[model samples]
Target: MNPRTVLVLGASGLIGRFVTDDLRARGFRVVGAARSLAPAQTMSALDIELPILALDTAALKRFLGKHSVDIVVNCLGVLQDGPGSSTGAVHRDFVARLLQAVADSGRAVRLVHISIPGTADADRTAFATTKREAERLIAASGVPYAILRPGFVVAPSAYGGSAMLRALAACPLDLPETEMATPFQPVAVEDISATIAWLAARHIGDASVKAVAWDLMQLEPVTMAGVIKQFRHALGTAGWPLAAIPSFMLDLGAKIGDLASTLGWASPMRSTAIAELRRGVRGDPSAWIAATGIAPKTPAEGIGRHPATIQDKWFARLFLVKALIFASLVAFWIVSGFIALFVSYRAAAGILIAHDFPPAPVDPITIGTSLMDISIGLLIVFRRTAAVGLVAGIVASLGYMVGAAILTPDLWVEPLGALVKTGPAIVLMLVALLMLDNR
Candidate 1:
């Protein structure tokens, strides 16, 4: 076992989770840190949940000193600036503070920063520019560091853009012709962890391993279409006929994704994601291969290592359906409320009147319930309160069902079957609640 301890920031992320587990398996004393230690968010119970981006230099230094950290793996990143994320704060400012903390800690701590591929000139969005700025800061900081740029990381567990790819492949859909032809090199998550483990094995004072930046990816040439084909083959959908989706539909999806982001949903179909997808993944991994003597696994080898199981198929199929489910639930509640409140107030109030409710209390009860329905819909629109909204919707639906059964049981026998239909809606809300956790 390695006596030196390592700290992994963003330990709950797609890459960080794998890296942390890999290092621990390799006998390194690993401390995994993330913004949330909640069981639903974190991969393991051992992870230290802390607001890493919010910490200043002094606080970070103190944290490093307390843990006796020998190596720091920074996997923290954001796709775009939205409600709770800023590219500048996460990619640039945090790096600056982290570098300062390493220097002030006065420990021989080696920093392993996870970054993206492509040169600064091609950096179009804040995500790309801020990442480039962080790379420059690390190089200039004089800290013993290694900036690793991984291309199209293909992990066993998918999230964000990777998950999007899986969903597309399962549905047997391809991007536009131009996008399909764009270059997209891929690397396995295992290779990334292996490289980090290799670096950790060397002494920090070893000059050859320190202060290096390398692009990590397979040498094979691959396009976006080629990558999707690999996934299709893995998922047993290669023979399925693919429908060529128009570019405008993609643009509209991105716009919808941007709106979802403002509501605290970290959707992968946002504008920045589309722009980067257009740019495609590009990098040179020859230097990395020669330096570490680690042969990166190609997409085929990586995906083939574990055949797609029933669980994998279920996840891929449900990925997009989850969004649709939430959308329908939101619309269901809101529209129902709107019709009762504005379009059919007389029809809604008359039901209560027919049940022998007092004229004064009837209107108040109808208005209050209608507003509550709208509030539930609004709550479900935001990611943070989605679970609460789903639960409230379910409870409200049940309340209406019971109230109808008691006051107007004949309504259940009505040809429209409105009360019976509420049962399915409640079930849908339960499903939404179950699928609410992003991690």
Candidate 2:
């Protein structure tokens, strides 16, 4: 008999990647689809780059028929609404269309949706409300469905909130006392995969698991502070004294994150994320554990299973610093232009005039270069155009260096070393470009 073929949407995500790999290893022919594929994912022939969200019901039906998929696992989700993301579109509309496509395809396809754990009253943010709506849609769609709500997913690869937690653990910092005390029950990624595998092993139209909604997480009570301390121990920084971060500072960071989101950056520290974090992760896992007979690992057991390598330490330390690096680069470019164009326009133009150049074009050249500098800074401020801006900044810096060497070679020996410092600035821009990818 041939193995069952499974299709995984959003296969490049943190949980989706692991689930795809795990299912394939267990003998299922897994087809992984994502909006964009990373360099590492290019090697997998089973992984296809696809914009599933944009597809209509008819198109999706064609896709399902083409793959002959027996099961569909939707791991696609966004932390909050941003420039390129819409919670309502992804969580509600997409699921509605998918349900229609599955029914229209005339295939016995089972949908295993990933959702959040919370009641209607706890749904303060759009992220939670939309997710809950998706679950409701799935239950009523007349399709074989299972909704698994995993709490505070802690996987080997970190992104968004998990990345933030690691950064906090690596540094000598902690959240405010009240925030730390919030309930934060965590679930291992392995347990999530195991539950899916168990469900797949059963017959497709099995009555036991039809239209089931289960919360997948450890039964032991854990708090945010406990989780962070476990991470600190894994990183060998448990003894480090942690300075409490002010609550106001967290709110300020969320506002800045919201601003960043408008520029196409999907920052995890947005107001929605803050509101959800404060609400805390709470759920009962007895039903899931009883059905699957799979025991979830506690925070200590999961985090301690593997020792932290140098790469782990480096990622944790650099997570928060990535924001600082971009902010500084933006400021550097804008301020340099502002100073030259407004503060000391005469001084800027005097260099060209003093270099024995024709007086006719000196002022225009000075003004054009200053405006170009400011333009690059503005481009870098938006996530969509950041790469173009960084590359342009590098080229412009080189042009200035070469032009100065030919025109005013004496400036290299100036007391401030202004001309000599352009080299480091160029290197910094290159660093920013390399670190731009969030996933």
Candidate 3:
């Protein structure tokens, strides 16, 4: 028989990308599916030559029918809730629709799904509820499926809580209070991919062992704060003292973050995420090892396998630096505008008058300029309009420098270098733009 054709959903995600590569290497014909073609082209580690299809239910069905797929591995998932999207829809509803499409086509496709280890059942939080619901849908869909529940998956490139851990490690801040430390069995992404590849290959022809739900976990579990210290050492950073905040505080912060997220902010610290953390991510790896005949590495071993690169170091340092730069830019403009309105109004009007702007319009000009500055700062604060805000900042900075040069040359040589300092201010704005791209 020809090699089994497998379609990997969420092919651009951290786990999905690795799973796609592993399946292809294991002599399976792999087709990667993602929400959009642009991210597939730019971010995915899947081969450029691999056939990438859309993730919509109808689109997936058409591709399956055309390709005669034997296995479908779903690596699709969301860490937090956002506008027009939620874990309920992305995790549960989408899979339900997918299973419905599969049943309608009458294809005997084996499904290998990735799920959270602790969330074997649904709960109140969106993360837990949708994950469990998806598992239920898979079980009831009549599609032969294998659910792989992984705990605290880690890779070279970090995101979500992993990134936060790295940040904590690289940070030099000292906290005065102690926080509750949760333990997790952090698994290697490679191990998860390997298990996924093995199951895809074996389940294609086997009817007896199809409906298995294995917990793919590490050999040992580590505390949350302890893991952060390990990652810090790996990044060549020294451990700093941390004050622990109560779990309830984390929940409250996450709740506030969720509200901000509705406005397009992508905070990993959502209430649902905090809830998941409190629940912990520990599971038995015995079943996975027996099924795949693969011995998974411990968390420390896994960390050693993927040695930190220069880029990892930069990411660790810049993650928080990016936020600082953004905040600084916002403050610079807003404070400058505030001062111009209250303290520098007369001086601002003098420039307009000296430049031959009508005297009657001088106050209006000053007020307009101050409002423009404050507005740009506010735009920079919100993620939805950050790009536009950065572009506007560049344009506004240039305009100010040119106008000041012609109209207020004396201010350039002032003791504070008020006009001359615009040069560095423009550069800072450029740096902020660069930091935003890192996201």
Task: Identify the runs in model 3 with alpha carbons over 4 angstroms from their true place.
Answer: 25-27, 37-57, 119-122, 173-180, 238-256, 305-307, 338-347, 354-356, 360-364
lDDT (Cα) of model 3:
0.74
Regions more than 4 Å wrong, model 1: 38-46
With candidate 1 superimposed using the best TM-score fit, by how many Å does residue 386's alpha carbon deviate from the native?
0.8
TM-score to true structure, per model: 0.98, 0.98, 0.87
Cα lDDT tens digits for candidate 3, 1-439: 8988888887766787777766777788887777644443343343333323225667657777887888888887877767656777788878887887677766888888888876445366777778888999998877889998888877766766777667767776421123335667788888887877777667455865568888887666676755665676677765455555555666676786687577666666777777777777777888778767888777677774455788888888877667678778889888888889988888877767876777787888899989989989889888879878888888998998888778777766779877677888889888888766423
lDDT of 1 at 373: 94
- In candidate 1, the residue pairs with backbone N, CA or C atoms under 3 Å apart (3 or more residues apart, or in different chains) clash, namely none
Report the lDDT tens digits of candidate 2 across residue range 1-439: 9998889999998899999999989999899999998988654788999989999999999999998998999998987887778999999999999999999999999999999886878899889999999998999999999999999999999988999999999999999998999999999999999998888888987999988899998998899999998999899999997799999999999999999899887787889988998999989999999999999999988886677899899999988988898889889889999999999999999988888889989988988999999999999999889999999999999999998898899988989999899999999999999989877
Candidate 2 wrongly placed segments (more than 4 Å): none
The stretch of ten residues in a row with the least summed lDDT in candidate 2 is: 37-46
| Model 3: how far residue 262 lies from native, Å | 2.5
